[model samples]
Target: MGANEALRVAFRTFGCKLNQVETETLAARFEVAGASIVGPDDGADLVVFNTCTVTSKAEQKARREMRLALRRNPDAVAAVTGCYAELDPEALAAVAPRTVVLPGSRKDALGGMAEALVAARLEGLDLLDELRRLAAAASGGLPDPFSFVPGEARFRSRVQLKVQDGCDNRCAYCRVCLARGRSVSLDPDEALRRATSLAAAGVPEIVLTGVNLSQYRSGGVGFPGLLELLVRGVPSAAFRVSSYEPDRADAAFMGAFSLPGVRPHLHLSAQSGSDRVLRAMGRRYGRDDVLRAAEAARSVRDDPFLGADIIVGFPGESDDDFRDTVGLLELMRPAWVHAFTFSPRPGTRAFDMKPRVPERVAVERAAVVQAIADRGKLEFARSRIGKTLVAVVEDGGDEAVLGDARRVFATSAEYLKLEVRGVPAGFHGSCACRVIGLSDGDGSADLVSIFI
Candidate 1:
């Protein structure tokens, strides 16, 4: 195609941080290939939907977005990729007949796909070979799923960097193992280079995301080493680690928070509070171990934003087991709880487990766990009522400005009409805001004013 006729592309991402990183990488590839990247509403010549299928709801959402994308740009060459595409390509194809379905492992081939689409438009003959050659030349013996080129993400403030890919765990309720193969880390030098560029771009935060981040091991260095290099090396930006397994929460891993730029937040997955349910689910950590990990993280950083994942109403869970989970939540009082009702995945071991919990019971258990989370969050917010927190001002709506507090509440929509304390320097975009009073309805605080 002529320079003026170069394709325009848009990407829509769903699911976890890994998907976000991959979406950024995909956008970079299109930019490098001379495609004009546009926002989802701009209606590009090519629309790429990066999907997730972690839960049934996620799958439905992905499908809904795919349909919407196709409707938005009916003439565009639609492409579907990521976990959802890998798991069910036919489903995606059915939704968008003209859509090109790319597998997760083959996502690196997007650049080649874009090239082919462009060349076919120009030559009006078969150009697949030319596109394939270009991709092979660019890869240069890197793995099939090549690491994304380091670049400033289109969204500048917060960048999701994929330090690792894939998973090796055999969790009974997870199909990630089938969707994404064994674990592998990105080259440490490449990661550092990307982080440096992000810092240079004035991005204040970079989150290290992966299928299983704890399994990061590259070039004779572990996750801790990579974190130390990033935290110490790139002093300009704050770094955050995404979800981690409890077994991976060792002293060295937790110690990275002591570094200047590392944020005090840890999201550990504790599927069940009952020991019996944990064993049945094939999770490594029990109730005690979960509490111990939480305590260890807190010990390193006082009042760190501790978070946990809780799956309620798994098969064979008794009422006492549910109560045990509530007891643990009360005792540990984590900053937040991601409550998910147990759903039997098609290929998972839990699918065939006997004495399955009824759907209604699972829903009720989820509500109970959610109540516990709400109570804990309120308590955490109340504890910080009179303190001043460094808030990263994100969205300034008509009623209030929203940002995360230091301790528990990450994003607060508290009204702005409260008494004035003082607005701190650089308070417009990001600043320190003093907490005056807690919102009576939700746990969000009524900001006294921005601290000067």
Candidate 2:
């Protein structure tokens, strides 16, 4: 088959921010190949469904979305890709027998789906070599997926670059290493080149993502060093780092955020607050280590939002252990908490760990941490209620909100749900918002009064 510009394509992405970035790359590949990328409901000739398999819930959600995509475009060529597809292709093929299934290991080739569809349209044209060539050129050995910059109109509001991939930190609860292999860090020069391109494309924020971001190393330059160089080179774009382990946060390393372009946010995952739980989970850091890291980051900047991931209920967790977690969170008083109950996946040591926490007990523990989190979140937002911060207008109107550095949800640079109202057109570009009312401890934001 040959290329066709008239083809209408659509993408439905699932899972984390990394999945979203891959989905955008897929859309760009199709658009670059002369396909019109459309919304899921817009009736497509080809539809790509990106799946995630982090949790059982995520896997089930991906399956549901796959079926929905098939229904949405009855005539569209179906394709499934991402972690779920890689981890369980057979189950996926069972549901959608004719669907093109791609796994996370081959994510670099997602762009080829557009070519495959076009080649299918051509009469008697063999495209095996062409498809392989296209995939390799776009990704393959050194996949620069985020470097595909189309235009400002088609540009992603946020550009995500994978400076690192895979994980070697065999945390007892993780299946990512099996699916994504060992870690591989990106070269710094290439990373800088990609960030420059995204900035040139008018991407406002660039999120540096990885399965194990702290593990990034290339040519004697560590993740922090690479970040320093990128900040100096790509000053046009603000940079953000995804979830990292607290052990990697050191004085000199955390000091890199002093660069003006690096967003003053550190999303470090402290799986459990108890040292016992941390050892059982095989995580390298302890409660004190995480606290020290948080303190270091906060000390470097003006109240940079320090968010964390905490697993509430793990195997063999005691009441004191849970309380220990709450105590740590109270001490850190983080801007946000990504708290969830521990999930047991097969092929992990934790799967066979003794004395599993009962589902009911786990749920209750999650609630306890959640309440702690809610209070901390609200207080964090209220902390900035009077300070004027540079608010980047993400959208406008009743639901319109603004973001700033720290990049949580930021106008406070937090994920605080503050509803915006009466933002005049003059408030459009280069605007500043004074911290005003915060949400009422619910997901809904407070009624935005004015642009103080």
Candidate 3:
């Protein structure tokens, strides 16, 4: 890159909403530092990969993508960070050339590094050497993913505010806890301040995200208390809660659902519906506890979009146990479910468990669960045919269209994907939309809605 030319940067994030938030924050920093942001395949001068390690599949995908991105832009500097990088920096460093491994703990250095790179306009071996030297000197510290750099511009319609990070539970099959360590929360006052600022900036929605939201606590405030504070303090911006623990879904926690500002979408970290499977997974709650949480969500809102995460074919999970899981889900009639086959992480207790479910059996069970979940999701979308929802336009402009369809894509407050029409050209931000029809069930299973 020449000194007169601006540095082009690309970002690729793999994993949860938390990782996405971190990527956005880093991109904002780079942008504010005068770096031009481009797509990963746009032949950028720098490519940043914010990776995940929750599943072996995720790590493998990250490695594959990293190699491809590096190959496409061989001279581009690749700065790898996040959980997978934190766990095994050496493995990621070996994936591609001109790579700088900055683990999650030391990610705070990215902003300063971006500023330096823009100022010096370093590239090729010189840029790689500088990044390596900086990475080695960077100390351990987790950056607040929600915090933005000074004068950072807000472009997205919705913001994911990560008020907490890490996990306290030692779930048997979970490697994330080992990578993230104990829970840490942003101070409630600071959280509220940041949320207020975001809402004031015309961000229509704010999703409170964390590794485990149920473990949030700071300045004598629990997760429920923090929710109440944010909901009441920023009534202008709609709120959404990310994946949370079932055990913590107590009366107080459920009360937050009653607030009008809080959207009617809730996803529980219910690993299994079978009590035996739950026990083996080292979960704190049982099957009935999950049911209670679901009931609470239903009681608070009309036809709320309820979701759960299920791990199938865990060690010692018999057919009967799987049946119990199906039964529980059937009773709950969740709007959506994320079903995954058990993945044994190297350091987790479940890795050494006996009488493991065969890989073939696990795959078959996962397929069955996924089929049911897909049907449930389609049914839920169909159920909202005549209902009006608050939706935010995520993509599509006046000139951006698919074939002859001049429509924009949006997401309802309940998290329903919508193929919206009759909105003005270049529409962005929240609007009242009524579900009118369903899209063709060919590939895109989105609900058809129109602006009222």
Candidate 4:
């Protein structure tokens, strides 16, 4: 490829924030390799599809995108990588005959992959083996040094940084551990260095994300120790942690939120609220532990936007179990509920368990749980109606503006209108907004004005 060949490339990512950060890192590598990044419609010479197989739906979506990419650029070299590719290489290869499947481990060697593709050597088995082997060899080396790059993020106002990778938990319903492999924490000094760069880039917020973030430990620095350093070391940007296990929600974790730069929102994964169901799902903690964690967070910060991920209709889940979950939600009244219908993953233990709930029953239970979740969110938002919230101005359009400016807003989609009475001006990017009225629907808010 000539230096001015203008090797246009496009990427589509699916799944969590860690995937996003990895994609960005890949894009950076591509740019360094002299590729011009472009949109999907630009008819790029190369297309990279980052796949996610967290759910059956996610797998289907990834396959659909792969096919679309093939159709969009039939002659263009198509590369597939991510958790889905790592878990099932054959499935990804079947998406397109010309598709080159790259294992997740090979993500760091993407610059070499790009070079091989440009030379049309991305065609045969030998090339694929070489790519895989190169990735395997590189995996043993220390993480390639990375610095946060500044630009307008396509998806959100805030950017996520992967301080660590992989998971140690074997939750019966989760396949992440299998896809990501064993838990491996990034070096603490490198993590802090990256955080400092992100802060320098004027990223207002940086969410620390990973498969099992609580298990992060490097150089005797635990998650909390790293969190303290990030908060104290990089005060220019707000910090947030992604989904965490309930057992990891200890006093030290709670104290991290007390830091001024730390976001008060906490997303704890409480898959079930019944002790029997928890044991069946192989969860480490019981329902009571979840409740206590919620209480502790509330104690630290009044009405913190606490969130939970609840799975309904797991194998052998009974009516009493469902009611117990409802009771727990009623008691804790989390800011929001991420209700998921139990879909048995291929390799998970839950897939083979007996007493499976019917598909219709699972759907019904999910709906019921969602109704309860809706009420909890409404109550949480109502509680903040008269309170002033630090609103991060996400998108300032003609009709509305939104963001996670403070702990008062229950939902990230909770946006305030610019036309509302008593609303102030210049609330375009990460400004505080006073809550005037609740939105008609529970999903958003009605702000009177932006507070300077």
Best by lDDT: 3
* RMSD of every prediction: 5.2, 4.7, 2.3, 5.1
Model 4, 288-349: lDDT tens digits are 88998888888887567778999988999999998898888888787678888888899999
Residue-level lDDT of model 1, residues 1-452, one tens digit each, is 33336667889999877777777877877776667789776867678888887788888898888788778777666777788777888888788665667766667667556656565545544333444354345444334553665453354445678888888788888877778888988888888888888887766677888888889999998898899999888998788887788877888887785665777778888878888889988988789988888888888876777778999878888899998898888877877799998877778898888788888998999998898887776676676677766554442333323333212222222212223333322333334557776555542434334443
Candidate 4 clash pair list: 390-405, 390-406, 391-405, 392-405, 393-430, 423-448, 423-449, 424-449, 424-450
After superposition of all CA atoms, the RMSD between model 1 and the true structure is 5.2
Residues 369-446 of candidate 2: C-alpha lDDT, one tens digit per residue: 888877776677777676665544453343334443111232323333444444554343223566566655455553
Name the candidate, 1 or 2, with the larger lDDT value: 1
Worst 10 residues of 1 by lDDT: 406-415
- The order by descending TM-score is 3, 2, 4, 1
Local distance difference test values of all predictions, in order: 0.72, 0.71, 0.84, 0.72
What TM-score, computed on C-alpha atoms, does each candidate reach? Answer: 0.83, 0.86, 0.95, 0.84
Candidate 3 lDDT by residue in tens digits, 156-272 = 787888889889999899988887778999889988988898888888888998899998989889999999999999989999998778888999988987789999999988888
Q: How many clashing residue pairs, candidate 1?
A: 8
Evaluated with TM-score, which candidate comes out highest?
Answer: 3
Per-residue lDDT, model 4, residue 316, is 95
The RMSD (Cα, Å) of candidate 4 is: 5.1
**lDDT score at residue 50, model 1, on the 0-100 scale:** 85
- Taking all chains together, the TM-score of candidate 4 against the true structure is 0.84
Error of 3 at 164 (Å): 0.5
